[model samples]
Target: MHFSLFLGPGVRGPHEDRPAIDLMIEQAVAADAAGFTAVYVGEQHFNNYEPYADGLTMAAFLAGRLPNAYLGTSVVPLVLHHPLFLVERANLLDQLTGGRFILGMSGGRPREGKTWHKHDLTPEQRSRLFDQKLDVMLRAWAHRAGDQPLEFTTDDEYGVMEGRMMPASYRRPHPLFAIGTNTPAKIAEAGRKGQKVHLGPFDPAGAGRIAALYRDSMVEGGHPAELIEDNLRWLIHTKIILVGETDDEAWDVAERLFTGPMVMAPWIRRDPGQDGWSLRKIYRADPGPFAPAMGVPESQGAFLHRTAIVGSPETVAAELAGYRDAGLPHVHARFIFGTLDDPEVFRRSFRLFTDEVMPRLGVETIPGPAGDQVQIF
Candidate 1:
């Protein structure tokens, strides 16, 4: 049951009252102190409105800020960059962090391709590009692994492979690679590559079904049968966690901050012709002329109560048993979502979660305040 500090930062929101760069740095430091296993940030550079234009840059900032805990991207949109460039930068980041880095990549949306890609590729083209780019990046890492600089190109030609990757990645066989996906085929593909994966929070039925799909495919893909379970352990289920001393308190905060405009900020600026328009409308319905609007049903109090764990420490621990039953080995806890503006509040919520919920969930914590024993970064 490894815990992680997950952040999906957007350009708009009340949290943006403070500059995003500063807030993320502060958030990373807090996670390290709280004994979180890792800190993951997103790359949502859909527009000038999106806060994190470059994930590796933020990954570097976090690597510098935290004494412990990993720094990783929610995803690097691989279709947007050359394989060599992405591999070099990521390997360098891993070296700088002393191997405490995780690499995650995604196929960018169509609108993003129109804006940033060298050519206007369709979604299918971008997906192919993602596969090709990632294939080259992995090969580059493998080439760097042996310090090999052989001039001959392989079946999959990566243009201009002149020199070995300097400061070779610290992680053996390269740092952990996680493929982001929402489909069963992609899940199987990630397993075929023996890479990790990221999926959204799902109910027991959904989670169990997905897990079964990945396991069966991994075995069929010639992944070592014995190691299939080990690989599945790398499946990170993302969820928003908001717990306090009491159920009422936790529920109130999650209901208030994690909804409506704050939750919808990331998609508001997207091209209307794309998926963002549907989301904008779905999340836009709650606002009114004289009243504070709530967000889309997904983030609202009732929906979240079922989909996410939002309760007191005791309740959170109990609800998590279902996830454990479904064989989820890890969860990326999003304590810093929506309009959670105050750092103290974030610290308090995380501390309460660590202090109480973690123990019941089989993780042992030394009885004391967060960062009391840990070195300040």
Candidate 2:
């Protein structure tokens, strides 16, 4: 199993005297020293949702520290920027990191905290735009000057661009690319393109369907039949984790840290209307069961049960073992929330997980592209 550290404080305000960037760097430094495989940050904007609006810049900052771990953007929203710029920046990051950069892509969510004049795009139009941008980026990275023209025109909203991709990406055809989403069609598309997938934390049954669709399409897209199942390791799953001596003790830590009265920022926040719902609504219509918990203790536990792994080492191993058996390629452990009152809590969580559970599960090092590892096509 591939183990990783996920850091992106969802909330960024008034919690501690230390600056948000400093806190994140501190966490990254600690995780690197402890030997976590990779570190990923999410792209969130405007609202105090995440300290950094640009995930690329944050990853670049971490790359400067140049830990042994790989650096990735949990996802960079492709719709918000021009593809040429996005690809150029991505290529630069790959060069800067010497091929260790993983470009995680996404179409973005509804209810973004920031206001974009292009926010009025219809669902169908947005999908088309995402496709166009992705095509442009891939062409640039693939150096497809013969297959595609260097200059192209896009919608007025994004504008036109022309330029040659001079500095080639460190990795041929660019560094690893992964498209993350829960939608079956998207997963199938990823399989068709031979790319990795940052799959959502769906239930086992839902995940099964995703894996099946992706694999079938992958084979149909010309991948060798023998390589089909072996490539399932790319379904990078996300989970919040905390360890303790026992289940009860673990629950206490979860409740105290996660469901505090002041209500720390959400570990993962996705608003409604971003997926094509009516924009007038303020709160999410599909708040889902967990989103509307209003920061209550019971609700927090329910949320964790829905998406986290919190328990003793033995308990955590039992649940995660089931996940591995179910065909997940990797696990991204989100250790701290925006509201963590102190940094020590996160550091301790990391130490315990690595010390106790990793050995039992036979997780010796960061994930490599072998042994059922999900391939980034």
TM-score winner among the candidates?
Answer: 2
lDDT (CA) per prediction = 0.65, 0.66
- lDDT (Cα, tens digit) per residue for candidate 1, span 88-199: 7887887777767778788754556556633567656667778877777777776843454634332224455656776677767676668877667888877776677877
TM value for model 2: 0.80
TM-score, per-candidate, Cα-based: 0.77, 0.80
lDDT (0-100) at residue 375 of candidate 1? 20
Judged by whole-model lDDT over C-alpha atoms, candidate 1 comes out at 0.65
lDDT of 2 by residue, 171-221 (tens): 765667788676777778878877778865554445556667887889879
Query: After best superposition, candidate 2 residue 223: deviation in angstroms?
Result: 0.9
Winner by lDDT: 2
Once fitted onto the true fold, the runs of candidate 1 whose alpha carbons sit more than 4 angstroms away are: 11-20, 46-50, 117-120, 144-158, 259-307, 340-343, 364-377
